[model samples]
Target chain A: MLETAVFVIRRDLLLAMRRRSDVLTVLLFFVIVVSLFPLGVGPEPALLRTIAPGVIWVAALLASMLALSRVFAQDYADGTLEQMLLSASPLSVIVAGKVLAHWLMTGLPLVLLAPVLALQFDVPQNFLGELMLSLLLGTPALSLIGTIGAALTLGLRGGGALVALLVLPLYIPVLIIGAGALDAAAAGLGAGAHLLLLGAFLVMAAAFAPWVAAVALRIALE
Target chain B: MLEAIDLQCTRGERTLFSGLDFRLRGGELLRIAGANGSGKTSLLRLLCGLLAPAGGSVRWHGEDIRRLREEYWGRLVYIGHANAIKDDLTAAENLAIACALGGHRVAAGALRSALDQLGIGGSEHRPARVLSQGQRRRVALARLALSEHSPLWILDEPFTALDARAVDIVQEMIASHVARGAAVVYTTHVELEIAVAVALRIDLGAAAV
Candidate 1:
């Protein structure tokens, strides 16, 4: 069963590798959105610093959502989703494998790119580490939770918009907790509790989101 | 190997089938026959646990298939309307991954042989997207060649978009599998004749069976 999950991850990663543009699209969106914020809001150092956490977190949220449809839309269209459901392994394992691959393709880039983009907002040197750390902790949760919306909205006429509607509301606590981590660090608080909370969200989302998404995929296919 | 007890199916507001019952055992062959939208594909989906019946239960070896999800699924092969091939991957890669996911063990050279037997032998190296509609269906049907040990095979429109020779090859594959004590269930518009000893048909569109 673990072998099946590994195979799914490898297969999806191979697909992503073949379509490099898809992976780059999400990363570039994160970069471009963050870059525009500094321009739209103007680069006053204190003001930029004040809105930096919120702007970056929101961009990450939207970027992750933009990539969410890729998680299942292609497979669902090509009928691989049916094969995945009928696999000898449990659906949850396959969902986890796909979710993990999605994070590596879409989520990991955002985490890796967040701190560099933070400099655009004139974020202080000391706060850069916290911005990256907060995203690193929170992005996987975004991918994990985003998959449920992807599954629920699968095959809908306007599933992409529906995914944003269904999942953005679910992302509230993540936004609060992730942005709070950076705010804490900027205030001379160690960011320990908020970081821990983000980790907790990752863990909790990891445990339940795959199972929920698997069930949704099953019903959607049915 | 499989049984449907008073199965009922509904697609949205319409009931496609109800009071559907059948028994299929190892070494037997059953074909589902129906007109379009008469629930031929729905019955196939229900048999494989892809669609839950609106009523009753589908069982394998006396246990509800829902409870025996992986256990039942691992022992069976199902090829639905979609080929499930990755257009970006070679035919070989597509076959290899599908076999692995279906829990069928493939030897080093078996993937090539499976494609070979299906007449797509050397084309295995080419990506599936370049394959014609018939060739793509051949690639999907190649799975039947590799999964000989699976006791049950459920196929929906297995003959769709295939040439006459390809159809014959698939029919022979099904006959050989059934001869080896593996049960087979399929739905197709094409009339089929198999050399196998046991053959049955469920005419789903004629009336609720």
Candidate 2:
């Protein structure tokens, strides 16, 4: 199982490396959308600081959503999904590997890039740690749950929009807790409870989402 | 043994086939022959445990394949109608990933030779998107060489985009696999000059009501 998971991760990373433009596009989208909010909402430092948590979290959500539809699209298009289903390893194991790889490719970048983007909103140095922590804890859940949506919408016409519709509702809890953590920190309150809840959500999603996605992938293939 | 007993398939209220039974043992080649829309692909999918039959069961070694699951799948290799090649990866990279996924960790030299045998030798480092349809098909077919340890092969129209020379290469590979006592179940509309003595042919068109 470990071998299969590692093989999958290596393969996906290699593919992502070959297609660097896709990864760059997602990063640029996150950066651009977050940058545009300061322009739209006016350049009041107080206002930008007040809205930083929500604005950054929302942009991260949209950036991750932009990548969700592609989680299974390439594999399904080329019939690799069928081959994956037929492998000796359990389908859920493969799904878990793919989800982990997806997070590594899409989610981790967002987490790493968030601090730099947050500085644009004049977020204080103290709260930046909390923001990054919340993202680090919350984005895996996004990738995991988004995988279920991706599997459910695989091969459908206009699936990109449909995947966002299916996944954004599920993402609300992560967004709330993630942004709420930063908000609590900025207000001089400890973010422990919110961070703990985000951790709980991650645990729940990690435990269940891969199996659900695997079943959904089978249905899509059928 | 691979067996399908009274297997019935219905796609969206349309019955594709009913009361289907067949057995494929080692050293046997079962060619599932049918015209388009005749459930040839469906039956292959069922045999690979990709789709559940509406009735009956597909069995391996007298155990239901669904129950056998990974153990059954471990010994079988199925190449569907679509060549599962990634456009961004080179032929060598594609083959390596495919082989790895299929539980075969082939060496780099072995991968190159396999692609060479399939007539894509010199182009192994080029992205699959740059390859012609026949070359891409050959990349997918390269799995046949690496899959020698697997006992059963389920190929769905393995010759679709191949030219005459490539077709002959694939046919020869299939024939030799059967000679080595590995069972083969394939669906093809093209007539193949395989060197097997009386390869079993199941015409799904005639079997369908």
Across B88-157, the per-residue lDDT of candidate 1 in tens digits comes to 9999989988898897657759999999999989899998989999899999999999998899999989
- Distance from true location, Cα of B188 in model 2, Å: 1.1
The regions of model 2 sitting more than 4 angstroms off are: B206-209
Model 2 agreement with the true structure over A1-222: per-residue lDDT tens digits: 668878998888988998989889999999999999988989899999999999999998999888888789999989998999998888899899999998899889999999999888898999888988999999899999999999999999999889988999999999999999999999999899999999999999999999999999999998
Q: What is the interface RMSD of candidate 1, in Å?
A: 0.8
True contacts kept of 1: 0.71
Candidate 1, clashing residue pairs?
A: B1-B25
In angstroms, give how far residue A121 of model 1 lies from its true place. 1.8
- Model 2, C-alpha of B151: deviation from truth (Å): 1.0
Which portions of model 1 show Cα errors greater than 4 Å? B105-108, B206-209
